[model samples]
Target: MILVIGGTGTTGRIVAAKLAERGHPTRIASRHPSTEGVRFDWYDPTTHPDALRDVRAIYAIPPVGEVDPAPIMLPFLERARSAGVRRVVLLSSSAIGPAGHGLGMVHARLGELFVQWAVLRPSWFMENFVGEQPHAVSAREQGEIVSATGTARVGFVDPADIAEVAVRALTDPTPHNTDHLITGPEALSYDEIAAVLSEVSGRPVKHRAIDPVGLAARHTANGIPPDFARFLASLDTAIAAGAEDRTTSTVADVTGRTPRTFRDFCRDRLRGDRPG
Candidate 1:
């Protein structure tokens, strides 16, 4: 059996569905016990035992809002290891490395605990345009997207591609004990992305670059925590410094197919979903 943590989340939901389609006995773990699965919370220790039951593989997502997830995750992973779970696939970020903060600590620890593990460091999701990312949706509605990234570009990857890679990492016999830097076929700036959305949806959209500090303040004003808001803005700051402007072949190499282009994502997901 496979246990999917954060199972109802963006990538987790897709991962669970794909695993189910492939005949895997999948159990979803979440804070709420809404589905036919287990209730699991990283901050709550009592929830771990039942969730770990009869599970051989785990799809793990670290608790959000913490600069270091190791305090919440390492203990649970220890329990999982003791309970005979062999394989683990972690959903991490492309910006984090072995020495970075937050997920990086978890990534380093995963290597020490499990011999069979894969870390997926996927770039920004293409779904951000049509889903929960406020800037993208706001662009569609108000005709302008705001960012601190300036002209820097990102090779935004598809969630489906990330899910497929997670599935393969979990079920494959070979232990891909390495980090996979997943990305789209091409890099695109926020301006280019806005142009694509405008063309696909037949609407006028523009990219507005703001100061990183101002962006952080804006996010804080919108109810995001001060530290997290600053951290998020820092990602854009790094992008403006040319941090995320790269593509990778890991998606094609692992999934046996090329990563979807931003144009493809816009065509399929944003073509008919224009803002009212």
Candidate 2:
């Protein structure tokens, strides 16, 4: 059976559903036990065994917002390995590299721990702008999207595309055994995204750029933990420096299908005169 960590989350649920659709024996790991998921929590090691029971492979979404997730993740991974789990698919971020900090540590460890593994480093999610997320809420209620990215462009990707590739990595006969830097079809600036939102919703939407310090302060005021809020703000500077101004064919190369575009995402999610 394939154990899907964080199975109730954005990409995890999609991954679990896809695995089931393909007739794979899928076990969903959640803090809340349900018919669809098994009880699991990263902070609680006692919950690991039940989730790892008879599992062959794993799709790991490590502890969120951890600048250093190695401590928690490495232990659990070792436990999974001891429990006979073989292949592992890690959901990493494009912002974090194998040689970089934070999840990068876990990224490096996965390769050493399991020969059959794939690391998915996907670009920023398009869903960040179409749901109840801060960006979306601000766009709807305040008529603008706030960021510290300045005028830099990012290869904003769809979660479904990421999930498709995750499914492939988990179930394929031959392990990918490498990291996939996944992205959408094109790169776009937050300014251009605002323009698209304006056209789709027929509203005067705009991107409100600010310094990382200011953004961090705002995020903290909005109830995010101060340290994590600062970390989130810091990542925007990487974008402003042109770190994400590129796209790749990893999606099509892995799934043998074209990944969806931002415009396509806007059309499908943002509708009914809403700013979604």
Best by lDDT: 2
User: What TM-score number comes out for model 1?
Assistant: 0.96
Q: Would you estimate the TM-scores of all the predictions?
A: 0.96, 0.97
Query: Any idea what lDDT model 2 has?
Result: 0.92
Stretches of candidate 1 off by over 4 Å are none
lDDT (10s digit) by residue, model 1, range 24-118: 99999999766597899999999999999999999998887766787778888988999999989999899898764577888988988987999
Against the reference, the lDDT scores of all candidates come to: 0.89, 0.92
Deviation (Å) of 25 in candidate 1: 1.0
Number of the top TM-score candidate: 2
Clashing pairs in 1: none
Give model 2's clash tally.
Answer: 0
